[model samples]
Target: MFGDTIAAISTAWGNSGIAIVRLSGPDAWAIAQRQVRLQTGAPLKPRFARNAVLLDEAGEVIDHILVLPFRAPHSYTGEDLVELHCHGGSLAAQRCLELLISGGARMALPGEYTRRAFENGRLDLSQAEAVGALIQARSNEALRAANRTLDGELTRAVGEIYEELTALGAEIEVGLDFPEEDVPYIADESLADRLEVVRQSLADLLERCSSGVILREGIRVAIVGRPNAGKSSLLNALLKESRAIVTAIPGTTRDVIEAVLTYRGIPLRLVDTAGITENYHDEVEAIGVERARAAMKEADVCVWVIDGSEPLHQEDVDRVHELADTPHLVVLNKADLPQQISEASLTALIPASTVISVSAAEGLRLDELKESLVGLVSGTGALDTGLNASSRQVEELRGAIASVGTGLKALGDGLDQALVSGCVGDARRSLSRILGGDRDEDLLHEIFGRFCIGK
Candidate 1:
């Protein structure tokens, strides 16, 4: 769609079997032909890889490579595209990119290729965002969720709701245009019922917000408790490695030890914080305790680790009490030893929390702990829908839902048809923004700026 050409190293910059230097735009094919010297002396063919020698602007050899070309409208970016498959490493790819740029192709900006795809009608705005999501996905579930969006699942879902709102707006507009009739085009009850359905549909999409985000971004779990309570041991057991130092000494963990566990295709970022207690052995220990509390406050769930082998101390009671209003799981740790604490006492303190007995040192029932953590964050639906709306998309859906609610209220109160129609129009505009139809240049830049160059 653009008059100029753009180039970049499509592959990651590192030593590998091959590195791709890509070019796109009107002059892509011409630039490739000028820089590539086919070994077979054959004409450059579209969709065929030809052995070639790449040359710089001064007529110097840069690298021996394969020249692959794609014609306009069929290639990515919907422009003539060329890929120079050169030897892997920073040198060849870098040199090839330099030559292409010198040959008149400008350096592609971060996510420029995908941005061009959006501009050329190859993908919608949500699909463009999905390309970045798929690139940054950290788990299998995240990948699947991103894939669904790239495949237009999100656009389709929003499209249905958008259509319903548009139809409602048209119905309301009929009465507004025929003010002389002084009669409603549709029954107020029927209009209210249809608007309610639209509101419910928007709410349903909004409901997927938490699960989608948790799937894409993962859940943060902070493991905290009194020192010598096997907090480090629990982290180690979950990660199946000695990621944190474990000892019988209290306040041994003087900092937050963080690691990640991918449980059931969802990432659980586990933070093992220093023990929490009023009694500190040193200034460092006190600081550690402060950090421990901070981690618990920030985490999606606090896995409160309590030593079951020891009698209930005031510290244990205080820590458990703190979790009363927080989303947390109580682990009565050291279960392999003779128990001195009863689950009843802790449950009575925090009647709503889940109490699981586990022996971290012996790796007892860690699977159950993981399962519980997954269930706590996974919500009560199948994650297969792959509708992971970003915070921006979620906010838009909320706005649309609010607008629909306003329209419903206006209709119920027998307000002017014009006002109700305006509400429907507002809802449609909000939904349109989600698909990039009504987005501005700055918003598009902010969204695509997060992408890596050559994407």
Candidate 2:
């Protein structure tokens, strides 16, 4: 229904050297032609640009401009397109859009153009989503992953797996069709082999998903520990700003103070939560303590700050043990002060826990802290390992893989053909959902809604 022709301020809406009013669909060329004379003035050739004057329907001058055009099936959206590279002023872009809308073009909806591209088969769902990723990518790593997905790296991998499954399913079908041949489709010996290969591939992709997730969504690391252990001070040190209160009094931060700090170009959401304590009498402090516990549970990484100047309190010991099952660290704060705890002592308590001694008071060993935090965030360097990254996608793949295993097991047991086929079909449908094949309207809407406008 969007083919009536759409126009929008395609370029950034602001004062600049140039702003673009883009038109796409069958009306694109017609709109451009009417605004420019092909004969009297040397007009812009198709796919090229020329300086021209933009005139209203009444033949009144709007602005002098450069016009560019691309024929259908060649440009973005796989549709005829026109771009009026007019003056960069925001008002000018607005006026151009107004003129076009008056000319019978509706404003483009968010991601409408990219949606058209998907509809027209110019790009797949993954590539279309990558458009938004590329635009919002914060770090070089994130941009590379987004570009890989946009360039069809992810789609190609998915397609390969789907192809393999299709062939395997077909083989299963053949065995089912000709029971007289008595050929075992899923041999017990070969079943494990095929599954191992496929499972390993999925595991590898799932591994990359972790890095891809960090690259795409970034990681949330919550700084938690007893108050006056320099939790706020650590936040400030990492963010290189006095973003949180650092009074000597305990529980100064009675709420979550968050900062977005980049490490190795990867964005890490460092959350400074209220110190985990048991003695706070104030209701607000109690709430903060509760929040801190909640944040630690939700975080991808937790940094436990223990004051090096003070003896290890049981409260600290108790909280450390709480995160023993989670990704955590022992950060001995105030290292510049007289050491009240030894490294051997700390490590013996939190075995296998990497301890980093730092002085938030004097800003000592923060570099090591950041290094350790980044390591804990994305691992020492697993971003290189491809990760399937999307938890939704991962879950879907897992479901499909499980169904395949069930089908293979049934085949091995020479179960009824219908039962085997049913499992295979179920698995295929799961894969189809990932590829956006035969997706419901709601699913498509939800997926596309995650995309930004223009993409």
Candidate 3:
């Protein structure tokens, strides 16, 4: 444990029921001893709370306070700790910290407290990272994922995979060392069977990474279409708010308007871009159109809004090819009005694309659209973010899976077990990386930087 005491107001700085000042270190309790005069009791005992009248160094009364102590190895940070429940006020907490500073404590750094917990081996790397994932989680899916990782769900899964790989490696090593023992060596099918099991697990895990990551980080969706094609209207419909301008005038929206909304418990960042059309009169509008194209390129998926209120134009047809390779949906807007374009005509242009007949103006079929969006994001083994997920795991499952394939192929080729052993060795390192076995220092610093001061 650190010898210097650290102090911070752990509660959020705002009007609340109460605010707490926390201290932990070897001298944590001693530093808090001098600042607040213990008006009603003897020295506070470890793990005990005492109702004491608080006073400044000048013996001036501060507040009626309760002090609790935790002894070394039993407390957070594995050191002596103290917590003072004080009145919830910014200035009051500041004064308390200042008083502590005058006595002995220094301000705690961002995530320093949690860093201490990590130093004390209270949590693994994944669980330590989970503290932040849990804080930033936006969906129930995300919450469940983080909780699972915090509770070691991903760890256990990875462990089972690793153990299988280890066993395979041991079998290969045995054959490598004792080829003359007349013992029956593992056959090609035997290796293939083990390799297939490992590959399936890895492929399944790889499939979920996309959806798992998106749930943890909100999915990016860009809406694109010709000018005045109800792109902004679609954003407003999805967000259920007048977040963007809608007008009869073409190109009214010359830039992107973004809003975050949850669809079926999954957070989505809907980017409503300026309508794409030829012959822009304004330079800014032209730039906005180019940027819209770029956004389409980068988004996880694109939503092409077709104005059900307008006639079919060549712009819609040509623009569809630009996103032909991109995952997209064909959204037909203005279902409330007399449809000028038939859905059949649009379906002829793109067969695989999902066509959602939606009225962004009246909010018709929006729920179905949301569900379609969910289905679009959720893939096979979509339980990536289920109650035991690890969104920030460091291991690369791809290489390990590939190595297993190579090993099996070598065995099939009748190559000696040395080559198989090498592949398995690489696989073991990859799995260990998931458990933060060989994590570098810079990643740790970068992670802790996101934490709020006072932890």
Candidate 4:
């Protein structure tokens, strides 16, 4: 799969000023040269752009294009590469791609170009994974976090730990080789101390993984409350648009309406669910109520909206009790009108949750509400640190931590040097896998599969 020359539309498909079609592999240059007629009628120069007339298999002019060539060992894929910059319309781009394919380049699979780059030593697994994260980032924080990973922040950290483990493993191996020696290659206390240090480093990285994953994958915030509690209004205000229908009708939102927005650089997925009510108008309302409950259950945080102008009702108390265990905030909506529910009374009802008053209808106190939401998710402002990790990376870090713990336990139990070394070796391999030093074909496929083609 990695041997064949591949090509795909590198830019988004649509009407625009220009679109890029990338071709990379051993035969990339030849395939591109076959489809292009150089204006100068001379050989194309590496790393230089040349005006060319793109030709179809039938020798018909498809489009006027600019050809940029990249030589081997200096290209993104570490192989010969070429990029065709043609008119942005689908007709011209598609025709040019067809010509390239007909000339011997095959369509690249999802993330295959980047996968080849990794296979060819242009990037490691972590950096390659960051490419997808960067493309999928929904906020500036997410983008910065992904950029940090792409710049080798995580890779360098892992590399440092891997080196330490390798050195420790070598010391243990030396001790294992000379069992009869009165003095070991590495003293037991010194080995245990070194392992403890490595364990602590892994522990710190794991500590950052929670905020890291949150930054990479935004938090899901479900807006749930009683009927006509201004759930839809709140969604509209947060999104700064009328995304949901706001009306006096109790069951206006019969299903979940979700939108993505950033709160202080933290990506937030606001989900406005059907108002929770004891009475059902019909089967549809009942289903909506059920879905609302499900959304609250799945969400990382829940915004419980209450009508501040109305007296506290039994339904409000019931909803509060139901979501008592979940991470939630009580929103007193309709603050623009006369207040009927006292903040003290609401706080007493839900002592564990933070309470905020706002007028979703008038867009009052929304900035404060957003800040509270950010605080709810980020306990220590770790998102500001710009660190990020994927679930796979977190899992590997945990595995390494566990192995180090096992080795520490073995050392404490006066186990054989061989057993301790074996544990250390396991930890080393786990860290190595994070950077693609150890091969895991299925894992590689899963990581790269999330990326778009021509990446």
Per-residue alpha-carbon lDDT of candidate 4 for residues 90-169, written as tens digits (9 for 90 to 100): 88988888888888999998998889889999889889988888888877878888888888888888889999999999
Write out the backbone clash pairs for model 4: none
**Candidate 2 versus the native: TM-score?**
0.91
Better of 1 and 2 by TM-score: 1
> Which segments of candidate 4 are over 4 A away from where they belong?
58-60, 180-192, 207-212, 314-325, 406-423
Task: Using TM-score as the measure, name the better of candidate 1 and candidate 4.
Answer: 1
Q: What root-mean-square deviation over C-alphas does model 3 reach?
A: 2.7
Model 3, 144-258: lDDT tens digits are 7778777886677778899998998888777767775654366667777888899898777666554556677767899988888889988998888899999989899888888
List the lowest-lDDT window of 10 residues for candidate 2.
Answer: 384-393
Residue ranges of candidate 1 with Cα displaced over 4 Å = 40-42, 57-61, 207-209, 314-325, 409-419
lDDT of 1 by residue, 1-455 (tens): 57889999999989999999999999998888888888987788889999999987777888899988998788878888999999999998998888888889999999999999989988898889888878878888888888888888889889999999888888878777775568788778898899898898888777665566777778899999988899999999999999999888888899998999888778899999998888897899989999998999899989988999998787776777777887789999999999999878777876778999999989999999998998887667466664766878888999999998998888778787788888899999999999999959999999989899999
Ranking by TM-score: 1, 2, 3, 4
What lDDT does model 2 reach? 0.77
| 2 against 4, candidate with superior TM-score | 2
Model 2, which residues run further than 4 Å from truth? Answer: 36-44, 384-391, 401-427
Ranking by lDDT: 4, 1, 3, 2
Q: Rate the local accuracy (lDDT) of all candidates.
A: 0.87, 0.77, 0.78, 0.87
TM-score of each model, paired residue for residue: 0.92, 0.91, 0.91, 0.89
Deviation in Å, model 2, residue 268 alpha carbon: 0.6
